[model samples]
Target: MLATRLIFVLSVVIGWTTACTPSDNSTSDIFIIGDDGPAPAETSGYFINHFGLLTTNLEVMKHFYGNVLGMRLMFEVHVTPEYSVTYMGHAQGGRNGTGFQTGTEMYREKNNLAGLLELVQFNVTDDSLVASTKRTNTFGHVGLIVPDIQETQDYLENHGIEILKRYGEPIQDFTGLIPNAFGLGEYAGAHIAAKKALMEAQGVIGIQLLLMVADPDGNLVEIQQQEQPAGAV
Candidate 1:
């Protein structure tokens, strides 16, 4: 009887311990829950998936991203009244990149391993709607992680692209890249900064060099080299 009672108590203790302990094999939330169902995840494997911008000159922008940067144009689409979309990415092995859909529009990819750049142009636009000022750093910017930073920088310079910010330099307007939804202002920012500092001290966090350049439409583009290159998709 005593042995049976001890076994029951041990079972109870084990059950309680298992219940209180955190899970090791738990999976992180990959999709957001909603009333209907989880919404499609916007980001690919990349932390930042893709960004789009309106351009006055499609051909010029295309040449800048395609010819100068050597990125492939995945596919072009014509949407409704006078709007066209072009997707570009670093093509590898002739495979299309990661494909994603927003609303009714479907965007394709050149490779699933990285994010993409979407270029939009309006064929018919009123003068009032078409702002004279181009998309510039004043608004915000997109960042890219490449294989080789110096080589990419040299290529841009040889193609007459001005590098606004050099590598290892603190990116001006860094907060602009972060969405306002992150709630990272003041107190939160200080807390995060402190945590990051602690992580860096412990060698838990890594750093990457960043370079800033302006695209054809004067849009600021930030590019960095990936610490490790991903295999072809």
Candidate 2:
């Protein structure tokens, strides 16, 4: 029954382009896969619009992201006096690689989806709120790349956010050893144990970590720095 329904939908989607033609006398006809239509334009818009973090304290989350992280305050609106939404971003820009402007007020502008952070706060809560953390849950941390990691680290510390690890801190590399080791960058000649040791010694495995902070809701936030080449902004 499921397969029959799928075939009907597929036939409509592909404009009745099926591998086998349907017979007038047969009620059941098998569907064979066929080619799709022309591919859509490559310039279509597709990206993360905004990530929302629900919290109990609105002011704290706003301060941490807006004041401490230097994210421009896009705007703030109260769903009610007890509930509100705050939008923040690295810069004033539009979503989908359009309408980017530096030093513009977030509220004054619109459609800035490039790296927009949406923070939501509700004054009321019950026992229904499920607790989550990066360590214990599938939810991941937000990755931000700043020009100066150390400066951000200092700001976070001054605001009392814990520094989980220093930039370039080494961790055990457990990425399964690939067969074609030659093209695996630094892992070319290194075995599993050797790779682990080398990573331990160099203290650089994945991207450099500047700090890890928690929102008022205990959501982990990971911060990192961007490497700028000589004379490049």
Candidate 3:
């Protein structure tokens, strides 16, 4: 009886704990939740399932993400009759990226892995709704996680991409939101993970306008290898 009672208590405690949860992002009441990121504490194995952009021309953006950026073309999925989900990218064989859906639009993986880009398109032919909307975050930026931050920065500058800097030093959130969200409550450990991820990110490619005061023009295009859990669909 004592053992059973102890187990029940443990379960109750765990239910109230953040660490054991499935990362449902319960605090999310708004769209574009962590755009002001070094993301929150729960970011591990999290790749953008989807992000929306506003543009007058889909072809122009596609040329960059698809042609110049080297994101693979997996398949085409319709978000709705009026919209589409263009699977512009994929990655992370182990660290799990997922898919996203909004209204009538839904996107998924070509395979079981994580980390893919889904560029939301309102109308392919006329390009009406998307053109009318301006999708830039208030900070006016794009973000990327490069494998070699220095190397990637150098390459971009050499190519005359005009690397912009908001901070004199590299930007990071050592105590990211993951720890906070999960209540792992390890400040030092979170910092180390943030540093490691920043150091190991590879080859971010694309054009981006930086936003926010923290890291301006940080990275709109990220080049990191992602991962997926075993048997993850």
lDDT of candidates 1 onward, in order: 0.56, 0.56, 0.39
For candidate 1, report its TM-score: 0.49
Estimate, for each residue in 113-174, the C-alpha lDDT of model 3 and write its tens digit.
44455565566456433111122223222344444445555665564454333212333333
**Tens digit of per-residue lDDT, candidate 1, span 1-233:** 97875665565545545665558844333122357564467743544545677786889999998788756766788887688998876644222343333312233333443456788888776542221123212345556767778888888889899877676554223233221111232324547544333323221111225667777776657677766434211
Q: Rank the candidates by TM-score, best first.
A: 2, 1, 3
- Cα lDDT, model 2, residue 124: 82
Question: How displaced is residue 126 in candidate 3, in Å?
Answer: 9.9
Q: Tens-digit lDDT track for model 2 on 116-169? A: 888877778663443234223444565667667888778778878776555545
Q: Which regions of candidate 3 fall more than 4 Å away from where they truly are?
A: 1-48, 77-83, 92-111, 123-142, 166-233
| Model 2 spans with C-alpha error above 4 angstroms | 1-43, 93-104, 128-135, 171-210, 228-233
Best by TM-score: 2
